[model samples]
Structure formats: C-alpha cells, structure tokens
Target: MSDTTNDTDAAGEGTATSDGDADRPTTSVEGAGEPAELDGLAVDEAVERVRAREPDRDPETVRAALGFVAEDGVVSRDALRESLKLTSKVLTTAETRVELAGIALDDAREAAESVPDLPTVEARLEDFAAEVAAVENRAAALGEDLQAVVDDRADPAARFAVADGLRQVDERAREVQRTADEIQFDLEAFERWLDSHAVRVRDLGEDLDALAASLDDLATAVDAIEAASTGDAVETAAGEAGGNAAADSDAGVDDPARAWFDATCSHRATGLTVADLRAELGDLRTWADREGADPVGEGGLDDLAARLDDLDGRHGALGERLDAAAEPEWTDRFGEAVAAVESDLADCAPPVDWGVVQSTVEEHRADIGSDA
Candidate 1:
C-alpha cells in the first residue's frame, strides 16, 4: 500500500478496494478526486424544493437529507443526488401518511387553517341546542292550548281564554321558529365560510356576531314571554277575572250550534293539527291536514249546515228555564179588565179621555169598548 492512502487519491485509486469494501457505502462525496467548488445555491434551491413539496415531512428526515452531502453550506453533485433521493423518499412517505391518516385532506386543511375558531364552533353548537329547546317548548305549549280549546267549548270566557292563549302560542312559536331558522342558517353559513377560507380567507367573526345577535334577540323575546306568563300581563290580557261572556250572560246560547259559531267565527284557520283541534274544529282540521281524505267520505259543508239547522229550536237547560218563567200566568185577569172598561164607559159617558179608553179597549181585545 502507498504511504498516503488518503481521500485525496485519484478516482480509480480510492475506489480500488476489496469486494466487501466495495459493497459498503461510499464515504466520499461527488467528484471524489477532482478539486471542484461546492455549489451553495444549488443546495439551497434543492432543499427549498423538497420543503415546498413535503412540508409535513419529519424534521429529522429533512435535516438528514439537507446534511447528506452538505458541508459548510456547500454541496457536491453526488451528495446532492443522494440528498434528493432521501428527500423524494421522505416526500413519498409523507404523502402516504397523509393519504392513510383516516381523514380527508380538505378537512385536514380546514382544521389547520382554522385552528383558533374551533372553540367558537363548539360554543355555537351549545347555543343551538338551547335555542332549539326553547323553540320546541313554545311549539309544544301552542299545541296544548289548541287541544284545550278543542276539548271544552262550554264557557265563552274559557274559549276566549284559549283563543288568546292560541294567539300567544302562535306568535311565540313563530318567533322561536324564525330564530331557529336563523341559527341554522348562520351555522351553515359558517361551515361554508370555513370551507372557502382557502379560496378566499374569511374570518368567522362576522357570522358569529350575527348568530350571537339572533340568540340575544331570542333570549329577550323568550324572557318577555316568560315574564308576561309569570306576571299578570298575560293573565289580565287573557281576562282571567272578566271578559267571560258566559259569566255575564245567564243564557248559554241556549243552543250548541249557535254557541260554537258565535265563539269560533273569528278564529284563525291555519297551522292547526289533528290533536290541537280535537272537538268541533278538530274534525275539520284533521280532514284538511289529510288533504281532504275523510275516512267516512260522506259529509260535506251542506251536511254540517244541516246539522246546525237541526239545532234551531233545540234549547239547552237555561233556555228551558227562561221559556218556563216567561209563560202567561192567568187569562181571567184580562177578562176582568175588559168588563171594567165597559162599565166605566157605560156610567161616565163621552169625552172621558178616549186615549185611556182606547188603550184599555185595545189591550182587552174584547167587545167592551167597540163604540169608542
């Protein structure tokens, strides 16, 4: 062996080794024997390309690739090729990991891009649940009011009470429903906004603000409704003490048909389900909700009118009492009055206030004052 068996040897000289050594990895860089200047620009450009292509690669792998053939910010062709091979392998591995991570790339991108807003989404979801609860409760109460009205139609006060309750329920239900729709809309808008951040980076603050405002409004409205209900506002409006026509009037319409009509002539005609209108109106609403699919399929408006006509003379208990009290007591008193009027005319002679004579004569309706 030469006294100088160094890395500075010529190309074929350093490569001339035992077969086992040849099989071992080469420790020398590109241009092993030649004195060539290292390319710094080329190294940085290649590293930048690898980084650009595989940003999520292992840092250690990236460092290893960058340091493979680099020495003092200088790189050789042979070292650059080996570094590129490592970087390509790392890039391929990163791609495989991303593909097999059991999540979508778009979802991953969205997660990374919107790192700070996740808590806001979670909070909004909680708000949505609460609002939905309120809305559903309002709808349920309205349904109950409608049902109570349908169940009993005896007292006008109670009927009007239910109507007022129905109106309140309808208003409250529709209000909450609007809020629910807005909440859903805002949430969907936020999702769409989040997804489009890549195309046009938009913050979710505006959407969040709008949703917050809507929730605030709903809270105010629900609070008002609750307060009105708990306090005397709604009760006074509902006429708890008075406004019951039935209470003021001694007669209960004396007829079921007239009573139902007088009570329900001004009621709203929509949004009622079968359970809400369970009484006289229940059948009508149920049929309407079924799209005119009446099971019996026989009775129409004419039949309903005929049924009302059947109750023309059908008086209730109160009507029977009134009729009995207002009946004539005695017919003998009328005859006595006529005999007295004839006796007065026979004895008193003419020009004796003919008006009175005529009045008595006409009331008696007998032959006592026929001459006058």
Candidate 2:
C-alpha cells in the first residue's frame, strides 16, 4: 500500500516521465527530467533511513526496487543517488585492483628481463669448457713428455778416449737435466697460477720467456755433450793405439784369444755407456718442446713424485745390470786403477750415476787394445 501511495504521490508531484512512455521509468528530478548528482554523505544517510524504515529488508534490495522503477513508475531520488554512489565505489575499487595487478605484471616482466638469455648462458659455459680442455691437454702433454724422457734409452754413440773429456760431457749432461728440472718446477708453478687466473695470451708471455730461456740452456748443454763425445771418440782411438804399443813392449807378445777377448769386452762396455748417454740426451731434446704445454690434475705433485720414484727403481735395475756386466776379467785388462774406477761406476744408479759409466768407458778406452 505504501509503495503504491509513494508512486502515485511522485507522479502527482510531477516526478513522472516527460515523454509519458509506458515502458520506462522517469527520474525524480523536478523539471530537468534527468538523474540528479549523487552526494556521498547524502547517499549514506538515505541508505540508513531505508534500513530503519524496512527493519528486516536489505538496504541494497530496497534501493534496487526504488531505483529501477517499473513501467510508468517513478524512481526515488535518494534510492537512485545511493545506487549511483555504490556503483561508483565498486568501479573505483575494481579499477584500483586492476592498476595494482598491472604493476605486479610489470615487476614480473622486469625480473624476467634481468636474467641472462639462453644464448648468453650457453656461450659462457662453452668458454669455460674450452679453457678447461686447454688446461687438461697441456697437463696430459707434460706427463707424456716426462714419461718419454724417463723411458728413453736406446741409442749409442762412439766411446770416450779421455777421462777428462768424458767428465766434461757428463757434467754438461747433468746441467741439461738440472735445467730441465727447473723448467719442470716453473711449469708446475705456472699451472698452479693458471688455476686462479684467466688464460690470457699476453699474461703468459713472461712465463713463456723463462721457459724459453731454460730450453736454450738445455739445448746448450746438449750441444756441449755432443761436441765432447765427438772429440773424445777421436782421442780415444789414438790413445788405444798408444796404450797397446806400450803393453806389447812391457809384457811381450800377448795371446791372440786374450787379445780378442779384451777388444770384445772393451767394445761392449763402451757401447753400453755411450748408448745410455745418447738416449738420455735425445730424450731431453724430445721433452724440451713439450714443456708447459699441458695441465696437471689434483695431487699432480704427488703423482710426479711417485713417477720419479718409479724412475729411480728402473735406474737401480739398470745399474745392477751394468755392474754385473762390468766383471773383473773385462775391467782388469784395463789396469787395477781403471778396474777400480769401472767397479765404482757399475755400483751407482743411472741418470744420476751415468757419469760413473762415462768414466769407466774412458778408462777402458785409454788401456784396452781394442779396434772393435
């Protein structure tokens, strides 16, 4: 009854549609025939009044009922105003939420952009792999060179005539070995340095210079030994002829078998000594070019030490063979003094003690009447 009365009163009060359309509702604004502007405080007060008047009805349902009037019905100004404010608030809140969502999307895009691209990451990984490969290859080459040097010992040279000449060659050989060892140490240090450094060609130049110098020294030492060995071979032939003449005059005619045995034994001893020296020198040359070309792995120093120990064992075995071959009969023909020298030489290890073998060969060359 109240609703009908309110609608009749509104129409009667000139709040009806201007066009007199039977299907559409008309605004409550007097002569303007349009919706009135809504006020926030006014809308709130109208909602509260509607809630109080209805007691049990929802304020939103009551506003919807009066705001969107039926055909030929009038819209309540307070209800229309309240509905407009409610819609504006909802649209504003939705717009704020959309803005916040947009900001979050922008932040996510920025974070994604900050990460390295796939190609860039792949390139870095490839660079690191290449560096590692180079280092490993270098280490592998070094180990191979070192092993080759340790195992090589198959070539022979001419005999030494003079002990002094032989000693000089031995000294030079030792110098070459010492320089090689120094280069090895430097290379190891360089490898360690590389562990913490980038592999730049310019940065490596200084170390390369030092290695080159060491290589030169090794070459020089090797050359000196070659010269000494050549010179000693010539002198040894002359000395053997002279020693034989002296022996024939002092001891009278010698037995042909005894002479043959002396020559054979002398030749064998000289051959062994010269071969060992030549092999070592040749191996040193082979090792020279490969220095610093490889990288060692973890515990490389310990591994190198173990390899050296193995080398020592090999040297010891070779020493035993040399000693066994340096028997009394073969050495005694040279003289008691030369025999003693030969014995001492045979008693020592190889590489480190190879000088002793050179000395023994010189003693034999000086006295042995051997054309063999």
Candidate 3:
C-alpha cells in the first residue's frame, strides 16, 4: 500500500496542476537515507555496469565520483542505477533535440527554391549565423559544467548543482528546436524574383560576349594583314636578283605593305577598345555604368538592351575599319565569326555559362587565324 501510494504521488495524483500549487521535481539532497539496495552491491560491479551501458562516457570520472559517494568502499547499487538512468535520460533528450534540429535545418535548406535579392538574403542569413553562434556558446558552457561535475566529485551538493545546470542546457536546446520548427521562409516567391532578374543579367552577358567576339575578329584581321605584308616583303627581297620579275613584284608587295601599316593602326585602336571592354566585364560597377545603365534598378532590362545597342554601334564601327584594311577575301571570315557568335547567343538560355561562350569564341577565332 505504501509503494502504491508512492507510485500514485509520482504520477501526479493528489497534486495540484495550478500555478503556485504545482509539484516540481527538486534537486534537493535532503532525502531520508540512502537505499539498502545501493548498499548491497559491490562498487566495482556497479561502475562496470555503467561503463558497459555508456561506452562513450568517461569511466574514470564515474568511478571517481562513485568512490567519493561510497562510505568505507561500500557503494549503493540502487543509487548507481538511478544516476545512470537519469544521466542517460538527460543526455538522450539533449542529443535528440540536436538531431531533430539538424533534420529541420536540412529540410529548410532543401525546401528553399531560391535565395532572394542580395541585401535581403544577406540579412536573413545573418540571423541564422547568430543562432548558430549562440548554440556553439551554449555547448561550450555545457562542456565547462561537465568539467565542473568531474572536479566536484568529492562534494555531492556541487555535483547536484552541475546536474541541474545540464538540465537547463537541455531545456535551452529544446527551445531552440521549437524556434526552428516555427520559422519558415517564403523561398518560392524569392525564386520567382531571382529568375526574373537572372534572365536580364543573362541577356547582358550575351551582349557583352557578342562585343568581345567582334574585338577578337578585328584582332585576327590585323594579324592576317601583318602576316601577308611580311610574306610579301620576304618574297620581294628574294626575287630582286631576277631584275624585271622583281620590279614587277614591287607594286603588288608595296600595296600589301601599305595595307599592313593601316591595319597596324587599326590593331592599336582595337586593342584599346578590347581593354576597355575587359575592364567593364571585370567590374560590375563599370558594366552597370556603361551608357549610364542601372542593371538592378527599374527598367533594368531596357537599360541593358540600350547598353547592348551601344555595343552593336562599337562593333559596326570596328568592323568597318577591319574590312577596309583587310584583304577582300578576309571580309567573309569576319562575317563568319559574327555568325558563329549569334548562333551561340541564340542557343544559350538563362544562367548562361560565359566561360563556355568565351571558349567557343576563342575556338572560332583560332579558325579565323588559321584561314588567314
């Protein structure tokens, strides 16, 4: 009957649930006496049992604490069992919260359709970063408490205080997990906003690529003209011993040499323009400022299109110079390079790989050089 009553008390019978009347578990060590069952078991056997159950636990710490609790080396089997059970329960609860929080965090990350605009997403990420730092600080404090538990092995009261501190840590972890569950992000909406802007950015990149290709064509045309002049100069000098034949060749060679000097001037102009374009591509601010376009502001697509039109103007101006200085047959090669770039731009979709486009331009540029 006494055991039945004690069980009922533990189950909250005859206990008020109302505020100021609720029965809370106390960490007080003012109990009547140690249980007889604890006195019956040997110290070594009880410690060994705890070690078997908790392989990760520091056996020496448990042994030292139990040794201190034992009177004249006679340990309490029931006390050891109760301590192990409570410790296991506390540790399991804390770890379970951590695992659940991890699963919730991973789920949140996976569910994210996209990150919103830079400034907004950065603010959101900062909040989570702070939460992570808080968790790390709490874990460090818990570790210090664990060390205190080991250091206070000779004092049962100090050990009990440390145990209470661990319980508080567990409670805090549970709260953090609850917060994680409550917080949700509207990632799908963010994705739509991002994709809308991404398309315009992609178009700007394509336009820049077309401009880069035109510069490459001009450079290749200059190289072809220089090569032809050098070859003609070499041939004219070699055939000078053949009197009239060499004299006849001089006019044709002089035309090529004159064209080479003109193309050299064009080369310098093309290089400066190429360098300017590279600088714009290398810096977002510079690119945005090109033709006073604001890529991230209202009517960004219109601004980018205007910038593209400016690029086209530069291309037409440069192509005219290349064609006038280049051999008539080489005009076809410049058109081919432009055609290839247009084909690539048409095939590209949103989230364009500019590296691949550049590489394709390079390959086509190589073909142009080989033809020259």
Candidate 4:
C-alpha cells in the first residue's frame, strides 16, 4: 500500500483516497524542495541560477533529468511559467537584446496575421522596446571604452615625438640631396674629359695605322725595284751570250780574230783596257774554233769591215734606247759612257794582215782552252 501511494505521488496526479483525503493534494512537497515553489523566489535570482547552472551542466545530465521527469509522468506548470518569465528578464539585459528584440517584433507581427491578438502583441512589442533601450545603453558604454583606447594612442607626447623625428629626417634628406648634386657635377666633368680623351686616342690610333700601312707599301716597292734590277742583270748576260753566238755564226765570212785584236789595240791606245771587253772577245774566238769554221782572208776582211760597221750602228741604237730607259738623274752619265765607247771604236786601225791575225787568235783560243 505504501509503494502504491509513492507511485501515485510520482505520477503528479491526485490519488483516490478514503473520505476527505480525496480532496487533498497528493504530491510530496518535501522532495520537491524550495526550487519546486516557483512563486517563492524572485524572477531575477531564479534566472541567474538557471543561467549559471545551465552553462556548466553537460547535455547528458540535462537530458537524463528530462527523461526521468517524462517517465514519472510529472509536469510542473508553475515552474514552466516561472522559467519563461526568467528567460524574458535575462534576454532583456543581454548584449544581443536589440537584435533579438527586432526578431521578436517581426515574429509578433507575423503571428498577429494568424491570430487575432493585437493587444497581446502590442504588449510584447513594448517589452521588446524597453529591452532594446537597455542594450543601447550597454552598446554606448562599449563605444566609450573603444574611444578611450583610441585617445591613448593619439596622446600629445606621442604626436610631438613623431613630429620631431620627421623634422630630423627632412634635414638629413636635404643634406643628402646636396651631396648628390656635388657628386653629379663631378661625374659630368669626368665624363666630358673621358669623351675628349677617347676622341684623341681614336685619332692617334688611326694615324699610327696609316703610317704603318705606308711603311709596308714602301718596303714592297723597294722589293719590286730590287727584283727588277736583278732581272735586268740576267737579261744583260743573256744578250751578251746572244751577241757572241751571232759573231761566231759570221766567223767563216769574216776575220773575227783580227777584228778582236784591232779592237783591243784601239782600246789600249785610248788608255782604257776594260778587262770585261777583252774577256768577251776572247770567248768569241774560242767559240768560233769550237764550231770548226774557215780562217780569215781578203774576203774575210771585207766581211769583217761590214760586221764592225753593223756593230757600231747597233751600239748607237742601244745607247739611244738606254737613254730612253734611264731615270732622268742617271741619263747623263749613261750617255757619256756610250759616247766614249763609240769614239774608241771609230779611231781603231790594224797593222797585222787578216790571215795572220786569224791564226794568232786560233792559237790564243787553243792556249786558253788548254789552260781551262
């Protein structure tokens, strides 16, 4: 029976009892504690306790309490009412109250369309406006705190220190600017000097190169002149050889030995016995004998006279040619030498007969060949 009474109290409904006991409340006010009497505590104190404990309680503990109450089939309408009033009081003082107030006003206006309760909605709107005013006061206090922080950053001593540093930097910048100007002036002067020196050096290099080229050209001209002189000497030797061959060819018709002897005598008479002329005449006589031609006689004498005249004419022509070929400065000396040789040949006279002269020449040639 005791268990049955406890179960009835847990169910939150009055149990049927004997007599007047049925009219009495069945719940045990003892287990409910002071919190169960929702009307006894002030709404502000209740809100404060709920807010503190709710933030600290785990979700499992809250869920377990709810489940236990649900299983017991217990419902406290007064506690529920008190909790709702506490929530409204707490939200009025919250930082987001203004935003919440706006949301609540919008919700109330939307609810008015579905329900005919203008007076209730108007009362709720007035409550929201009062809460918003409190939030505005809190926001104004926060704004003042932010301004104080800003003012501390913009203090007079701090501003003065910044200004002093800026002035010093400006003065130093001007000094640096002056130094830069001086450096630029010096650089410009150095560049000008460098430009002038560069031009002079380039001109000097060009002049040196021209001088070297001219010297190279002069050297090449000298080499060409020397080569030409050597060629002339070779041609002269060849001409002498040719002349000797021609004389030998004419030997059978002339007394070459007699003519040579007479020419030598005439050269001696002029106080000029050139060894080269003598050697040439000697070579002619030897070549004639080597060819095995006839000795000289009267007919040979006539041929000899004709050959001498032909030689004289050729010598004159050679002199004229030499004069034409000679440099202006060298022509006079060359002409004089040619004239002397012609004069000596013209003055020559022979005493030996052409036959005897021919025999003597043949003997001399034999002697020279034997000696060689």
Question: By TM-score, who's the top model here?
Answer: 3
- Give the worst 10-residue stretch by lDDT in candidate 4: 1-10
Q: How close is candidate 2 to the true structure, as a TM-score?
A: 0.18
Q: Name model 3 segments beyond 4 Å from true.
A: 1-85, 99-116, 154-163, 166-170, 176-372
Pairwise lDDT winner, candidates 2 and 4: 2
Q: Please give the clash total of every predicted structure, in order.
A: 1, 7, 3, 0
Candidate structures ordered by TM-score, highest first: 3, 1, 2, 4
Q: Model 4, 133-220: lDDT tens per residue?
A: 5544554453343233222222221221222232332333344334334433433342332234233233333433443353344334
How displaced is residue 93 in candidate 2, in Å?
95
Show where candidate 4 strays beyond 4 Å. 1-97, 154-372
lDDT of 4 at 281: 32
lDDT for residue 128 in candidate 3, whole number 0-100: 47
- lDDT by residue for model 3 (1-372), tens: 011111323222233354644333222223323321223345676466445544575767656655533545555433433443344345445544544544544454453334322333333344544554565455445445544443332233233233344345445545654543333232333333234445435644665676667566665655566556445555667677554443333333334534443343344333334444333333433334553545456545555546655665665665565555555444443655555654654553323334455565566556656444
The 0-to-1 C-alpha lDDT of every candidate, in the order given, reads: 0.36, 0.36, 0.45, 0.35
Please give the range of 10 consecutive residues that has the lowest summed lDDT in model 2: 153-162
Clashing pairs in 1: 277-282
